[model samples]
Target: MTATDGIRVVTLAGEIDHDTGDTLRHALDATGESCPRIVIDMGQVTFMDSSGINILIAAHRALSEAGGWLRLAAPARNVMRTIHIVGIDALIDCRETLSQALSD
Candidate 1:
């Protein structure tokens, strides 16, 4: 995790399924109410399933309710496809690069 440009960036790697989804959820929750804007660096995330999507949606809802937002950055092709399939790409901003997410 890193904090720069007034955003908290959480770098995730590998597959995020039921087994690993909790880790991501915990990381999101750890951001706390103080730090609402989050950029999840998914450049290294090769796969994601429903569980992963659920966690992301939950985080987004929490952040949005707090008047903040969550962004996804650089998801792998397959992961991006999954996110789109679940329609999360519409609810959250998905960027091709971390810099883009941090920029806007």
Candidate 2:
């Protein structure tokens, strides 16, 4: 029997903006195809703006529609607060670590 293990880990670092958003989006799209569980590791992401949040939201929606899940792992304080302030936390799951997110 073939066990269907569907988990994808995306580790992101540095700033996320219009220039990088497209690259991130493309990467997510490619990864989302095989993994039902998408975990974005943002522990090293030092900066994130509104465009970054939008990219995440868009990916979340796309994955959800595909009967999958999207989650954020270990966002920096500023990134976490931005997500909270923008209410993105209500839409996607956020955890303290990649291990925690994967365990869930």
Best-fitting candidate, scored by lDDT: 1
| lDDT of each candidate versus the true structure | 0.89, 0.83
In model 2, which regions exceed 4 Å deviation? 1-5, 30-35
lDDT score of residue 84 within candidate 2: 94
Pairs that clash in candidate 1: none
lDDT for model 1: 0.89
Q: In candidate 2, what residue range of length 10 has the lowest lDDT sum?
A: 1-10
- The candidate that achieves the highest TM-score relative to the unseen native structure: 1
Q: Which stretches of candidate 1 lie over 4 Å from their true place?
A: 30-32
Clashes of each: 0, 0
TM-scores of all predicted structures: 0.93, 0.88
lDDT of 1 by residue, 12-101 (tens): 998899999778888898444664899999999888888989999999999988888899999998898888888999999999999999
